[model samples]
Target: MQNDASTHPEGPAASDTPATPDAPVAAFPTTRAKGCPFDPPAELTRLREERPLTRLRYPDGHVGWLATGHAAVRAILGDVRFSSRYELAHVPFDTGFTGELPPAPTGDMTGIDAPEHTRYRRLLAGKFTVRRMRLLTERVEQITTEHLDAMERRGPVVDLMEAYARPIPALMICELLGVPYADQDMFQRHVATSMTLSSSEEERAAAMVAIDEYMRKLVMGKRTTPTDDLLGDLTTSDLTDDELTGIGGFLLGAGLDTTANMIAFGTFALLSNPDQLAALRAEPGLVDQAVEELMRYATIAQTGLRAALEDVEVEGRLIRKGESVALSMEAANRDPARFPDPDRLDLRRKATGHLGFGHGIHQCLGQQLARVEMRVAFPALLTRFPTLRLAAAPEDVPLREGMNIYGVHELPVTWGEAGGA
Candidate 1:
């Protein structure tokens, strides 16, 4: 299937003189201000305003394009001409060690271009259809209630990230992949450590091998017993053991980390905006729109990397073949032309073309599952507790700095004992 990319008109005219080719080179992966935890790095936002498509110098000293505008980023994601091949792309910000890149591991659809990606996506597509996701709603509601109950039992005050945020997606993905909930901690720890950018190469490699081994075991089990779950469903397909294992690893890590952060960050964003929180509480019907607005407002996955397969023209700029491009999804979602008053957190706004779940063939496969989780969980937490607020001072909530995934490291929260609506 041809996934449609977000198509929005170009934003206001480029600033006078445009980021003069003489403009001082700003490092990629710029830092966000502590005071403005919800905003993208000021430098990145400024880059968008000044010249959405400008030069980006990678750590290895390769100068490429950075697409911060809605149109430009979407164009890159939707176009097959830009390669997602693992070895060809440049790491946007890291200044650490360098070497030749290996091909994307089996089943990692994001790392490969067409044909292969098309095959994996086609096989997995039926498993996450809209109907199937909606059918999982009752179970999601049950899971949310169970966690909320646990929080109420252990609370008044708790780290929502630990007690609420991470486990919901963790358990859901485990259930989908036929992973035993008892073993969730093992894979959870591995996935978490793997996401830490500061981790040493040895540490990252170890985590990858550990998770892959665990998935290998699960895939072998499915082959023998073939219980009814996503992994089991795949066991009947023509995929090899390596491919099955890789798919399991990809699905679990992707489903868990991204959705977990979204839940936590979305909660933090809503809590910081009391009026927005109240509006959501008062009007239950607004859940779907509110989810989209929150996603656009606080995109958890910060950036995506793509390398040019061939020279391409994007928004009047000529990107040469083999040059890397960083698609700043955070900035694209906030482009003024796409979203008026782009910085404001307005739940009622029509955030139709936001790049939060991404766009094109690589657009998140499990987005509907995420939407269902948030749509059910958010309201359930607020309505059940009636008095939910942050336990720590807003400024003191530890942010996950320098990580690919953006979110609060710990969300200390308190709520009244009352459980009734």
Candidate 2:
């Protein structure tokens, strides 16, 4: 199950520096040469076996270690040795890191250490509870059905990303935030452009500014005339106006792009794997397990960024404080130790601890909602379009390359007559 150096070639040197006392010692290859190697797990596996704690030369030429093994990645992600809080330090990865970092919504909820992150996350937890998410099931179904209906009316060849993937979650998020449906288009546009690798600095900056302005307005409206939505509930809480606006921006940005990408990517995985798709078609009850498998196979968030909080030894290497690290969940999900034949997609795969939603306290907050959306959307999609097939050749499909999130730019699909059941 493990790949040897003979099977997989050694990637480019991690950096010029030799192993230091309190830094990542081994040199690993940079994704700059290959443009985010997470797409092909073979490359990640090579790194895992050969250079588990090697340095990665980012596009900007900054050196950061890329952790490639299952145990190491999970240990580091859960361990306090590595810190997710990076607001104060001169982020090494930030330089030339083209991905736009939206202005901290909720002020510093994303990059702060415990106590602060704990408090903010606590306030937000009740909002995304399973009970709250269950209450949203009927609405989610309605939203999914509405989008599917629109797609059918549009015709045979439909861009699933535009017609289905984006709208379902976009509309759901809009309903949750209590924003008017008319404004969903504007919010969707800004968030989409901001996440693209092709977007210019000016374009990304504009998107953030536009989103911030919209969130500020929405926060004010909620304060004056509250509705029974997430925003209104937040206003009543002790969080400040700035914090409220921050939450709005965070919800819009995170909820829109991530879930949309998941929908598109998850659909691509299902369509490409005929056996798994067929099994789901035969036994519809396995949809939940199928969704979990999809999340593991299509780890949309390829790698997560964290900084070393203090000196710590992992797998016999000493990592110093302030050093940047990239945890490759894509590799972790495929680790043979965790799952048998990690590459193959299995509908019945017992995928309990997959890091697709992440691990530890900083794990994704909207995971419950995301799971519900996927659980409802996919089975319904297949059952509706029994003969659904990929519109483009698997090799020719245009995947969003070089971005942190792995997704298809567009998913073109065709279905037979009598589209929905």
Candidate 3:
């Protein structure tokens, strides 16, 4: 999550430094070119091209591996020899070396590999199927329209992040998880704290405590009186309340921040590329491909981390036991071999294999829901306001450079009038 400007300059001149065994390579970079915020950092791209699997120096000064190429990234993620266990992972952050990492908390599926992970996945996968998510489309459309209506009434300009991007997913996820949407501010604040790199350890601990306490109470309510929601539906299962609390907390945090950023970042990408925007607005049928391309183009969940359980040969390179590999989905999505003219945002391109939702067993569980939100929200926003455009200059818009998720903190957008370009 470090974007050392001095170490990583903006532009084509970024990755001049070589990645020798002794030299530490940045796991994921926020130092992307200032001129075009959509592209991955030039240094990262150069490394991907030069050495897809190469040596990386961790903040703890231990050496690991960095996976940049699409093939190598997928291999690392899919291979069972590599472990996703939290204790096995080498911390990838820039500061405060925590030499010994803690084990994944109970029900933190992403942190633990199967068959424990299998249990959670099996329990929840049925609920997140395409048909189930699509069933909520009407509600999603209503949410999108309501927000757009608010924006229309508010006038020529508004902060789309707070107004539209954040609320829709917050509401839907709360409904699905049975968390009270009225308490969104508490969880949203927790997400904000965790995503911001500048947040102190104390702040993060407090945020975790707040969200954990809230989830525990919410789970108790589900146990006492089962409602009609994802959490409520799971009350009959044999899983303990502790496990349920962990799962709910994990799902709530995972579902909220991701789709919210996808909306904000996807919109930013569209507004930045007017040609694509024009294409989308002109052809309503292109929504599916547009959403896929945007997911590939602005891979907000930038990096995937895992450590080797044993020596494994991946993409002709050996990753030894206990070594961490930082999978740069941002760089991998933009790999020319996987995506022709990778830098260009071509909506028509078949971005099927892109690492947008990630790959292998741990791919995004809520991708269907995220897709529903984007597919519903984007076109409707464009069609509703033909004149929708960035209210501020491109360079002036705030980017979440320091955080793990890539997006704008606030997107100030404006239109000529309701239904006018």
Runs in model 3 lying further than 4 Å from the true structure: 1-29, 417-421
Candidate 2's residue-wise lDDT over 160-265, tens digit each?
9988998888888888888887888888788767666566677877987898899898899889998998889889999888878877887777787788889888
The sequence of per-residue lDDT tens digits that candidate 3 reaches over residues 285-369 is: 9999999999999888888788777768887776666677788898999998889998999899889988888778898899999
Q: Would you list the rank order by lDDT, best first?
A: 1, 3, 2
Clash count (model 3, backbone only) = 0
409 Cα displacement, candidate 3 (Å): 0.8
Model 2 misplacement above 4 A:
1-41, 58-63, 87-108, 198-200, 417-421
TM match of model 2 to true structure: 0.86
Give the clash count for each candidate.
0, 1, 0
Q: 266-354, model 1: which lDDT tens digit per residue? A: 99999999999999999989999999999999998778878776668999887776777788999999899789999999999989899
- Candidate 1 residue pairs that clash: none
| Model 1 quality (TM-score) | 0.93
